[model samples]
Target: MSKGKDSPAKDGKRKSKFSDAADSPKKSKKASTSANAAASSSTSKAGSGQATLSVKGSGSSFKQLSKSGAAFASFADYNPAPSTKFSIYRADGLPDETGASTNDTDERLLLAGETDTMAYVGNNFEFGSSSEARGYTGHYMVGVYDPSSSSVTLRAVPTFQVARSIKANSSLSSISSKRTFADYGEMTAARRALGDAFGNRKQKANARNQDRMKVDTANMEVILDDFTGGIQDNLASLPSLDEVLASSTSSRPMPPANLDAKHPAEAYRISDLIPSEIFKSLPIQKLIDNVSDPEALKELLPYSKDFPAWIWSRLVDNLQRSSHLSGGSGGKKHTTFDEDEDEAASVTNAEDVMMMPALGATEDKEDAKTKVRIAYYMSLLWYIQSRPKSVSQRGKLITALKLDGEDANKRIVKAILGTFTETPANSDRAVMSAFHQTKVLAYMCALALHLDNFSVDHDKLARNCNIPPATLRELFRTLGCTASVVGGEKRMVLKTPFTLPQPRKGKAGGRK
Candidate 1:
């Protein structure tokens, strides 16, 4: 994003490797001279009390606006002619790296016919003087080129004057890594001690999280949600590729040009996006296994009665999709309701009570893993739909849902249905039960949606959730879910919703 003709190095320290030969000292000489001359003339007028510089536009993007519109407009038209003079010094211009040339070049040069001494200017300067003037000998300048239109302009002297005062013999001493015997040993030792202490604290936290991954499955779910959420937010907020391409039109202001092409928008295409440590940090396999069993998850969420019901509903919706139960992909399976079921049930009530959607007339006879893959694909769709329009709006909605939960669980439950993935399949008892009984469902959805790009830290995830990965794995297995892909090798697709088992297998059988 550097504005210079050449880009900077990785650490933003060295000059850009791609900088053109045009950026060399020779090319800059003419403009530098013009700038210096303009600066000198303005300074002379101001010193003689003939004119005063007026500065404005401080603390804003448009800094130093001119007093008159015409003057400001004409300022853009200001261009200098190329200089013919050459610098007395070598390529770098300065006589020695010590920077002593600034003072010695003019004042102590003891050159003939010299009355007053001058100093070497900034990064840009030209070796030239007016016909009647006498000053510095080591000065230099170069011309500025416009490659796009094949044009060139001389530097304005005013720019040179400003450059001289602000640049030139400025020392890099503060940032130099080069050390000397003059440095205090005790100060260095103290700084290192403090840094070690902070590093140890961080290591301890990492170790603790690593330990938690062994026993805590629920916490892993939460961590996954955080990671997923962060990535999605970043993705949603990033400027599109087209927007970035548009910036390449001009060279005046720099663009964020160094972005890697491989990292373009779709993060799913990259495998490295999911860190190996993420698998170790959470019980991903466990959750994928247990996504089917409604009964087990029912008991897991009872302790947190205050958990928002909508979040739970969203989770169930996601789980259903992940299990391939939301949309029918394979066989037609009939979902029959009781003969006494009411037609006038409220929409919220409709969601609370699982209905057999006419679409899923056939069931997918796939194994647990296939089911899980299907569920994951379905859940991804649901997650995107359930995400809040904006962070602030989502926060406000969550706050309202929480307050509703405290007042009436049913109120919260109704709100939960509103956030469910817009699936066509009817909800079953298992889905409703899972949402009603546990907040884990909702938390998992948030985690997946948030950290879709990154890998989970299983240990941290499990510790925070207070559930073992093994247990989650069992739950999903019971529910008929998998962690793998359900359909195409290129992408995942959710197949169908999970089927709830009645109290007992009766004479009527599963279809009856």
Candidate 2:
């Protein structure tokens, strides 16, 4: 052995300097081409996910064009995009040149994907049942031709089976005597007489001899001419890939179908944009009830913009308290005591009550921060409508409510109420219907929560959440609340068996 012989490591794992030098140019060229392709795709705005096809000296082929031109001509490309359009025409099979097809017997056929623009010309011939006396069955040949190419493509393989027997459902005499097609006028000049065969007769023959393709499948030959012809046909008939894709997607929001002019998503978005504080202190449910009429709601909802999320929240709080004070559901009523009971609230109220409240300021500054709590509650509502994930995004929620602009909340509510009352026709009516009950429920929940009345029916509480009545009742039962019929009707009322506040760490804790 020579000392200069290659070592084991060099042979298996290492590239020699000579080899590396030889490969450098190839690697460099590959990298350059890839980078250029990427750059071209980006600058030309080509459809995403489309494969780039290129050819050298291909001349006028899409591949030879610049990226922009390629993209523009994508429809004419032979390859099918995900977004292609096609129309299906029903026919039993190819008709005779005389333009007649018979459907007396059920026929088997294959369904396959095809280019939208290509057309195949097929001819028909007739086959006889026997070497001697049977009528002629039709024969059809489907062939493809391309104007751009000189070659012809013969399509349709004959390996398939033919029905062993075709029952003569029509009168044998009628079939023999018929001069014109049953359905079309061109089927005249009888090729063969079926005559009066009482039953089906088995005739052994191949698919082509029987004038039909056999069971299961058919293969078509696609020649160069056919392929080119197909490409040209597709270019003229099919929409561009971009158009196809755009047509497939919907532009409108998919909220509850019956959303009002202020869509639920839009309303929820607006609520999200507001601060949570506005909803905290106000008796929102009572506010809703007091402004139950559309006109009043319209008047008050826009003013809501002047205050922050906390103020709106406060309104909800106030509304809830008012509902409790007024006695929800119009049952037995009791007079206000204002005695040793409510001592804490009374003392707090006495200290905090003021002749007038300023923006973002309450007589009791700490209580005024109730706005933060208001913002918190509205955020939850927003989540239920806009973000169904059941997680909170405090910043996003607050911002959404604020972005609704001044009085947007009130404006939306007013519009909702108006829609409910008017119940416009068509899509408008649908939108109004969705808001009608939901808005009412929102106010009801605001009232119940603010009053801290766990005794209030949980089912009813959920009803205030603006869900379908049945759904609200189920939720109430799930939460261990009892359902009651109200007003001697099918309408249901939700009530808790009793009120108890589950003690929690927070100071805001109250009756469940």
Candidate 3:
């Protein structure tokens, strides 16, 4: 009996659970229908022309409308009236207090169901010519008026002010086209006076010629003064040529006893090899001659370290000055050096002199000139690479070179390569020796930094440097540098650490 009761109870529980699950979906469907109905009702109300009247933009309820144009009004519920009219009245102090009106004499008829109409209400509404008496300025009352019922329905009562005249006379008061007989007569008289002033052509021409002659005379005087002033002064101050040569050729001036004591070998060696007159004539001699200040002479130690240093510094300086005076001709105009046989022979001899023997020992003038040309180019390249302050001069040089044509850059690259490769025998050894003596390896590295973006191509750099690709790789490796293959190209990059000086800030009370 207990088991039979338990079975009926289980059946009842199953039926109850099934009924609850079915009822949940029905309830959700009814709720969704009610929500949709509410949304539809709100949409219908919005579509029924129940929009609040306001300006298109926010911030202010009262709009500043132009007196000569129509203003729009949004309606809450649009209803057409055949006799609807828009009236504008001057309301000065209070809303209830009505003063003068534009519509008192004439009303602007508005079309039924129209949102906008011409609000200007005077027959003589000439914009700029309308006066304050015509109710064009100050606070205004604007509303929809029905003529049949004699009732006004207030809309937006925007303040009206006279619009700035877009016509010519309003903005440009000084200009006017109105002309009288007197004005025309005055213009004609002025023209005639000008014509009379310039009537005599021969006299005008003579006067112009006289002025030009006077200008030329003045210019000539200026030129004469510029040309003669410095020459005359210098001539008067100059010593006799014989006396000058004697002084220059005199025995080499001795450094102070203290300097000789400190550097006996250097002093004796320098004195024996260099004549006093010749040594004194050096450009750097002036700096060295200040024996009273031995401290300043320390700057010459770097150049005096080795014989080559001393010779090369002076040689490079002379070469640079000559190049500057010649405008960097670089032996480009010498026809003798242009022949392929002569060039090949010269290159071969240069290689022997550079690689096998010491530099400055060659007695051949042609070889010397060629070396000088190469040295000049190297000096210039070094200057441009190492000196940040020379950027302007570099730009000028580049522009001048580019005047040669589109291949000017290529020509320059060839010239740079020749410096490295012109020595046919042991090109790498010769290039290394020249660069070491001149301390131009840093300049070359700086140049590589400048010519390429970040990575310099091995073949292109070798061509520009005028060395074998393998030689260049070895050179970079010797300098403790490395190369990597990127995008199927072998590239080398040298990075050196440097610090830029920070700009000094102005004092608080200082002038800018």
Give me the candidate number with maximum TM-score.
Answer: 2
Clashing pairs in 3: 252-276
Provide the clash count, candidate 2. Answer: 64
Location of the lowest summed lDDT over 10 successive residues in candidate 2: 53-62
lDDT per residue for candidate 1 within 134-239, as digits (tens), equals 2522212222333332222222121222111223323466435565645656766565566557758776576567657857577898899999999999999988
Instruction: Give TM-scores for every candidate, taking all chains together and pairing residue i with residue i.
Output: 0.17, 0.21, 0.15
Clashes of each: 79, 64, 1
Q: What tens digits encode model 3's per-residue C-alpha lDDT throughout 1-512?
A: 01222332233223222222222222344553553454344333332212111111111212222223344333433333445454443322212226434332222222122223312222222332223334533223233333332222222233223222223344355434566688888986686566558758875566567657854465888888988998999999999997885565332121111122222222112233323343333333333243234345334322222222212332332332333333322422121111232232234232322111112222233333333433333334443333323233323444432222235434553443333222446433223234332234433442232223224565654443444678656544433345777567677643332121234699899996
Between candidates 1 and 2, the TM-score winner: 2
lDDT-wise, the better of 2 and 3 is 3
- What tens digits encode model 2's per-residue C-alpha lDDT throughout 400-494? 44323345444433332332233344533223234433443343333333222222344333333334666544433333334454334232222
**Ranking, TM-score, top scorer first:** 2, 1, 3
List the RMSD of every prediction in angstroms.
Answer: 31.1, 31.9, 29.1
